[model samples]
Target: MTATLDHQPIHSWLTDMDGVLVHEEAALPGAAEFIAALQQYGRPFLVLTNNSIFTPRDLRARLSRSGIDIPEESIWTSALATARFLAEQKPGAAAYVIGEAGLTSAMHEEGFILADSDVEFVVLGETRTYSFEAITRAIRLITGGAKFIATNPDVSGPSAEGPLPATGAVAAMITAATGIRPYYVGKPNPLMMRTALNRIGAHSETSIMIGDRMDTDVKSGLEAGMRSVLVLTGSTQEHELTKYPYRPTAVLDGIADVVPLVEQLTPHESVELDED
Candidate 1:
């Protein structure tokens, strides 16, 4: 059950939330066991998601309803990463924010002012209600020379019915009108992974990233110098592996398979959690 990458034992974990652990409000096979194992072993870990619609507290409640007991502090969303990035880039900056509570809450916590006129940035995040008036306003603001920032680059998000237009899709529309591309702060940028690592005080050399997507999760983990594992419980299929030039460090059937690996992680002196 000892999981090692490049002969180094893994002491920390970064896992994608939806596909690898749950699907449509249902916990995937062995997900609970994987989390339980991590908790039992005192391994530092974080549940990552590109979805910016809900806050960590909201996500924790949702997961708890599904019988997964993830702590609110253990959940990391694209909204939080975006907020952290912006806080470092420009403290107390004014922004024209377009998103839900998750995005807005993070911005407010970082001391960002959400306004319409004379903003320094136009921040975009995922929301079920994509208002035409809001999108138009975002386009106008960006056209007026405000820097564009998006939570994630996911073009579409999965729902009970089917795929829904997400941040990337809206960002594309804004880009088309303003001739400016948005700075995405979520997965595939590696900034998200790095930030999560920093939050847990974990190093990339001894951490593992588990995700269901090859494009975002695996790619970001690989770039961040962590071991990447692709689980087939989500979007990317086994056959689709041939399409990507880069491969994950390991491929498994689902998060259930990762439970045993958690028990095998090398022991660390202390578990650190970033409160700020």
Candidate 2:
């Protein structure tokens, strides 16, 4: 429906990465052109993700391997949002972090001192392997009066074998143990979307939020006042849309289908390869 005559004029854009642009390490069709369209139109945009495992530099390289060319500055992750949130809440605070390089790097960049104990916050993120030792330390810290923060709320993610426990699942275990709920700072939270929009100088009204999941990307965008687009390329399916209380502005098969609409949206734009 994106290429139809009744399409709205989108001044800026935000899109999810995994299912919308690439799936299982392969760039989906039209993923490249969709990004090209945004640049051609001189539209300020950011690619959003709930995964906090990789930094933008890492993600940029991964996307490149999949044939999608996105600059490091154009990519936004839960780690970045989490870091921004912590920094705003308390500059130079200490945190007991449980995650990978993405989360740790973000905390360090935000002037957070990684503490062994007696920290202000317990930060959790995604990792290939969840350590009992690490989670135990996190529980101990949170129970000791440190605030609990998680990058995203996703319970499981797809893998070659099957679904694997994600950050949310681990957070649930911590919550169950300590009787404390961790503040999720990723998608489905308006804070993440608003932060991304602010970084790109885009307004929710003029921007479009595109994603494969209705629960997070679509819902968060709608809640943040942006037009939402539900793509049927990932976790959420067509039959699932009716289950949600809210709806996207439009639905499309995948990002590949967005190419024509993008071409039309930036007719006068001098499209170029953005290599930053």
Candidate 3:
């Protein structure tokens, strides 16, 4: 299908990864072409995700296996946002991280220390398993004066069988225990969107955000003052648009429709895969 994109020709693009470009482990139709189009046109773009389990390198490899060619630097995560937020709040502060490499490595990059005791933040994020033991420890830390922070507000995420408990779900449990709500650093909290834009040196006025979920991706983009697009390939359905007070700038079938618009918006240059 041809692109339904506007004539405004957004100079910068920010798009979500899992549902917008791929579903589960499979790349959606035209996802690769859309990435290639962005690169070929030399328009700055970043693939955004709230999943804190996998690092960028790990996610890049996973996408490569699915026929998507997003470079490590071109991807942004909630982990990165949380880390940056923590660093800005208190440079070199310690944290009791309850997450995987994506969340922990980002803290390390910002020169933050990871410890089980005397930490300033209880960094909560997604993991393969949310053990009861870990939750108890996090609760104790928060109660003992450690601040609460979470990657995203997603209560659950897509799974093969159904939705699985995500970061927000775990965060809720901790909140129930400590009565301290976490400062969520990911989408729906425009800080994450702005951080991604800053990472690519893009401005909100000239950039556009695309994603499958209106609650997070579209809402965050709107809150960030960027144009938003809701692709009906993920969590949000077409009929659900009216349920929200705000609306996206455009709604397309999927990323397949975005390539033509990218080609029309910028000058074409050749983009190729690396011979690793």
Clashing pairs in 1: none
Candidate 1: regions farther than 4 A off: 1-6, 267-276
lDDT-based ranking: 1, 3, 2
Candidate 2, backbone clash total: 0
lDDT of 1 by residue, 1-276 (tens): 122354667788999999988999999989889999999989999999999999999999999888899999999999999999999999999999999999999999999999998999999999999999999999999989999999999999988788999999999999999999999999999999999999999999889899999999999999999988889899999889999999887788888877767765455432221111
Question: TM-score of every model?
Answer: 0.94, 0.93, 0.93
- The candidate maximizing TM-score is 1
Superpose all Cα atoms of candidate 2 onto the true structure and report the RMSD in Å to 1 decimal. Answer: 4.7
Assess each prediction's global lDDT (C-alpha) against the native: 0.90, 0.87, 0.88
**Residue 162 CA error for candidate 1 (Å)?**
1.3
Cα RMSD, each candidate: 5.1, 4.7, 5.4
- Candidate 3 per-residue lDDT, tens place, 1-276, comes to 222334344789999998889888999999999999989879899999999988999999999999989899999999999999889999999899999999989999999999989999999999978899989999999999999999999998878999899999999999998899999999999999999999999889778898999999999999999988788898899889889998887778888876766776543232221111
TM-score between model 1 and native: 0.94
Minimal lDDT window, size 10, model 2: 267-276
> Which 10 consecutive positions of candidate 3 have the poorest summed lDDT?
267-276
